[model samples]
Target chain A: MSDPIFTAENVKQHYLIRQGMFADPIVLRAVDGASFVLNRGRTLAVVGESGCGKSTLARMVTMIEDPTEGRMTIDGSEILPGAASRDAVLRSRVQIVFQDPYGSLNPRQTIGKTLMEPLLINRKDVPAQERERRAREMLDLVGLRPEYFDRYPHMFSGGQRQRIAVARALMLDPEVLVLDEPVSALDLSIQSQILNLLVDLQDRLGLAYLFISHDLSVVRHVANEVMVMYLGKPVEQGPKDAVFAAPRHPYTKALMSATPTADPSRRQERIKLSGELPSPMAVPPGCPFHPRCWRASDRCRKDMPTLEGDAHRFACFNPIEA
Target chain B: MTEITETPATATGPAHPSPLREFWQYFSDNRGAVAGLVVFAAFFLVAVFAPLIAPYPPHEQFRDHLLQPPFWQPGGTLQFPLGTDPLGRDMLSRLIFGARYSFFIGMVVVSIASFFGVVIGVIAGFAPSWLDTLIMRLMDIVLSFPSLLLALVLVAVLGPSLMNAMIAIAVVLQPHFVRLTRAAVLSERPKDYVTAAKVAGAKPGRLMFVTVLPNCLAPIIVQAALSFSSAILDAAALGFLGMGAQPPTPEWGTMLAESREFILRAWWVVTFPGLCILFAVLAINLMGDGLRDALDPKLKRS
Candidate 1:
């Protein structure tokens, strides 16, 4: 259970956005210090508000773009900056499933061609028939039928298209998959089906998953461990049960209360936090979430707090205990 | 095109129409496009069968028929229905043969312009900011010149002839396609499919030409159609300017050029050729409109 298949150490992705021709560029710290280790057959859900650098982190782990700073490794191979371009074997070890299934798969390509693309591009040594065979096998593994082999993506519904996207990610037999809001675009009924398909695939293959989502309910349903992020940095990290049961950070507690529960008879205290998330360009000087935190102290406003604690960890000067 | 794989292959479902069939369905809905198609089809057959259907050879001179009026005119004879040029060449036969030249010119010019334009544009779109800026600035320089004048200068340097004229037109027209393709590629480059391809380890060339290029094709196709008609117009303009197909080649514009002086005396000499160019260009423009309506999904009615 403790065997790790993927790891990232203090990963930071900063983008310099130019203001104008004469103005100096401001750096957007998209993913400012993300560290996590994923065990095989387990899922790590990263929950954050929109623009909290969730997708940026997914891009880093998937090796779509190298992190501006820090280290990432998949199946023990260290993913150095620009190494994905030079060393494809290391890149192919991890794949990504995107949020918009409609946008992720090539509209021009047929479903089988879409599935076969990873193999075609990476495993050129494999014969055409072999590639076709493996692709069809993957379609079945993703719970799609055999007849979908030649149809374009527009013909399928959102859930089916997402299944195709998942199938494409699995085509190369990657040890890890970065699911970037994989179910957010899907209908509520369809979401559970796709989630079940993902869980089944994970169980059968023992693949590690870095699931990114803003929806706390979906995270609770699929994740073994959860990391709550605010303003491009993780505010709290722990096992899903522990974090969901007792969120130590102010931001995490606010996020958790916003999630609706099924128990109609039970009265729930929805913690209404004030102030919207600050723009990443002008993040506050001290604690990033201090502006919205009810328990903010003068010390919290003066000095940035580092993530501190044991198995259950949070970054706050004056913290709440559960 | 098999049935969609995700759905169960039940024979009861409506069959997905072929893309061509669907395109035709949408295209035929535009009545003006269909009418254009009919007119263009008749014109195409005339061009294809010019040698067999034309009563007289395109260049054959009936010396007595010089500047003869059309068959409807008082002195006109049925032998030359649309009348003759100053050279006594049958206007009908010459117009028929001229269609062939126009078609040939349009095909060649569009092919040459689009091939180079798409290639360069995709490169520019995929290239880093510095290289992209450099390529676009160069395209801008080319586009800054009035197309016909630039083509005239190019043909002047290349020496006036049919092939050289086409080469000039293609060079002049290439910038439009390049701008179009680059715009399309820029929009498409950020799409998730392109990122997926990159994540799959597709090389840069494959990503540009194979993955990104296909998605950009709808706009390119519309541009190509529009460019097709313009190519003909430009070629005819060049021919009229004596920078394109030379005399006695039966080109419509050259026919107009040959009879420029005779226009006041013998209206048929210029009128027939002018009408031919107008109708040909008009029909193609209508077809291009239809293509745009069909290819752009946003324009499709619910």
Candidate 2:
């Protein structure tokens, strides 16, 4: 009923690949025509193979890279493309938690300084003492001892560092958090802890999450909705329950079947697709996923499939029956 | 996902060794580095109290005692323990006074070079475009010349004074810092933390200076230490060539120059100033090596 906290319409990001002095520059569409809306307290998990533009989409959401084409509205305010044109207020509304725990936090900065930076930068009116108090509070909120504030990033374990990263993102009380594979780099045991922390944080703060990951099991636990991307384009999107139970697009069905299950006896029939992912620079003409898609037909090769339907939108000439 | 056990948060208090203490522990492990540090501290103290500690005023030459050997030798006295220069200035006194020149030049040149170099380098790296191209091109042109040669030219143009020599040495050293900082900034610019800072509404200046500059400091600090010694060497070289710290100034390089004619007869005149230069440079270089090893994250103790 209420307006979504974040909305993207036909977003596209293309990077110019220059081969040499003579060759014409090729346009590599890293994220092509991705459309989604995420409401407050909801998680939109973007699942795709490596180089499927999931991270690029996250970059667009975080406003680190502007979409070459499309309109993105954060909390009903539009985000412009150029560096100078970017709205600082809207930027403060959305923050990102990066993948590598070691690389994400500045190694030279103490945890207290790292956590206090966003607050100092975004909330300039806040006094230094107040900021310090808030940083200590955030450290406690993220399950870290306040005394750890003086410690540098290297002192913390990977999971603890990720928690610090999440805390830093929440320092400005942003409406949205773009998590780009936040737990993919962690060990299996630590993965669940971070996911639980994320879920708990989202529940407490009512924050929208654009969760980008290649790990389906992790997505299944954290995501309310799922969007499947192929190459650079989305092929399927729907509520997580419906999508996981009955994946409509052939690509989504294949992905769901490929996900490893704990019990061997409960394994479903595997649908392995053939061939490596088509290069984004030279994508198939009609359907981006056609080269590797088993269900791809002449019609699928001749014309692109547009997403249709209200609740469970999918783009495929031959979608699986629910 | 449901089997999450809360790991009890351990308070990181006095029980945990601080990074400074850890650094010291590692630093103290290297005997050569500790010796270098002690030697450097001795030189620093001598430089600071050269006037009070030296047996005689640096310029108060003992014409009668000219060319005296060390105190251990026949002609040397306790008052002129290191003996007198060709100018009859106390060798020990002049050597003590010369420490101030070496240390002063090293500190001043490195400070000036690093400040300007880091500012320009960071700006060029963060705002890469025509501005970067222009700055880099200018640096390339400057770098193409041999650093000492460029210093020579600058000193020539500036007319051979202590201040001129300092400025010339700084000019010679600026390109190195610029390149070092630019390379560091360029690498750090694309890192995820930089992007995260941008997403968190950090302005260009804050992102470059606050987020990125601190990360680039380790290499810069190491380069600064190494450059300090080089600055001292270059200043001494200029003084030797009669372009810096002219007559009666008691600079080590001038002492060496003045004593060259008397070297065959009065060995202490040239030898002591030369040894002073050697020890000061060696101590600084060793300390710099230790710092590089200590600050290097890859070498951190497991």
Candidate 3:
């Protein structure tokens, strides 16, 4: 395989809960030892329920946040913690599209002003007229009218606002787009429009996506690969077809069963896990998913499972297929 | 629209309108703002043209007209329609002349206090560290003192004069502006756009001004309006206590103070100046309320 556009190795993000000045801090492992790779022109969708540290992972990948213990690289440059200069280089190469389109764009600013911000910041060498030309080109590429350059964010609908956001991100001609639930905030129909737009843009621009979301169905439509997470840990990851068709991890199975399908005639057997997700602050010993895992054995509880497979990987010793 | 990928023409600033056209658009949409602005302009006119219009010098005493009522009064003269004070100075002339001093104090005090307060607040809020601790604690110490009492102490120490009163009131009022600005900046600091600006590689200075400060303007503006009226009231209060503009100066508060002895015998002396104070404060408060409503983005949508 060719060099991946981005790679995250054993990423860990621990949030400290300070009780008092003198007291010892309790560390919550929000993202624990998660790993992934994104190749050029391919998308890797990280899916999990809320609080699974999926968004944290996206922040890390985009360099908006730094992992407590891990190494993340874009192309060949390693991202350093608190190194603003290094981060800017990483930021120019990769951009993020936020969830709320209404809030993602500044209300006081016109679309033209908002889009020009990134280009002006990154490409100061480009002449003013050349910059305007590039901004208009970006707007057109995102399927917006050139006249909308003067209109404020309030004039646009949810989908159109998202389109503006996408256009703004594209101003720097970034290679990687870190979308944190980009389509989840829109209506079902509008979600498809945005998804299709993203796919079309990807094909045209040869972009890679680190798509973070909680919806597996949405991921299935756009993701080339899917990584399932449970309580800040990656339980399973594989090609989109292989993972969705035959999920090995029990949590993944439970999540898939919970998703509502459109076909009313088809009856799918449901798998329900017992109890709520345990707090990351007090994550249990050995296998973290044992409390709800149906196939939890003595060995599963005593020892942790590591990612062990060929191209596909699962951290579950008692995976269903196995 | 043509799918103009990689085109160079579209990235520049939008078409600029002439200054006259831009002003017309801004003012037309802001009629209420215009009305408040006009009332303030008239006040400015009164301040500027006081010397030209006053029939006599503000402090020049006419011994023959002592205790004479206003022209509209039963025994009032046409030359002094607003009548004379106990010192026999023209009430109308003195009030007109008082405009220059009052406005000077109001603007200078507010400007000084606002400048120092805004700088302190923005810096404290943006830079969260030992500096924040030092600044916030200093603000808290200042806030612990009652503003009027602090001004009174300051005026006593500085020796009472119009300029001294202004400096004292400004020092007393500085903490409130700092509190307002810090609150505004603190909340705006976490907004996603500021985060976006950071992600765009904006430096600390650019991010503070371009992203954070603009968003914080609405609240700061409202605070400034509220502060102006309160500052005016505090200045009048200081004058009433004889620690402000002093006797024969015809400042509203000093007028009230000097006329209180004759209030029963010549009620117009106190009533008109009190009315002026009342109208000015009410008008300022009404405009402030209007600004608070207009500046709200949620209210704008409704």
Clashes of 3: 9
**Cα lDDT of model 1 by residue, B65-149, tens digit:** 8888999999998989888888888989999999999999999999999999999999999999999999999999999999999
Q: Could you give the candidate ranking by lDDT, starting with the highest?
A: 1, 2, 3
| Per-prediction TM-score to the true structure, in the order listed | 0.95, 0.95, 0.92
True contacts kept of each: 0.63, 0.62, 0.32
Any runs in candidate 3 off by more than 4 Å, and if so which?
Answer: A1-3, A85-87, B1-36
Interface RMSD of each: 4.9, 3.4, 6.7
lDDT of 3 at B136: 87
lDDT of 3: 0.80
Q: What is the C-alpha lDDT of each candidate?
A: 0.89, 0.86, 0.80
Model 2 vs. true fold: TM:
0.95
* Each prediction's RMSD to truth: 3.0, 2.3, 4.0
Q: What does candidate 1's lDDT look like per residue over A180-270, in tens digits?
A: 9999999997888899888989999999999999999999999999999988999899899999998889899899899999998987999
**Top lDDT hit:** 1
- Candidate 2's C-alpha runs over 4 A off are A1-3, A82-88, B1-26, B294-298
Q: What is the lDDT of residue A207 in candidate 2?
A: 93
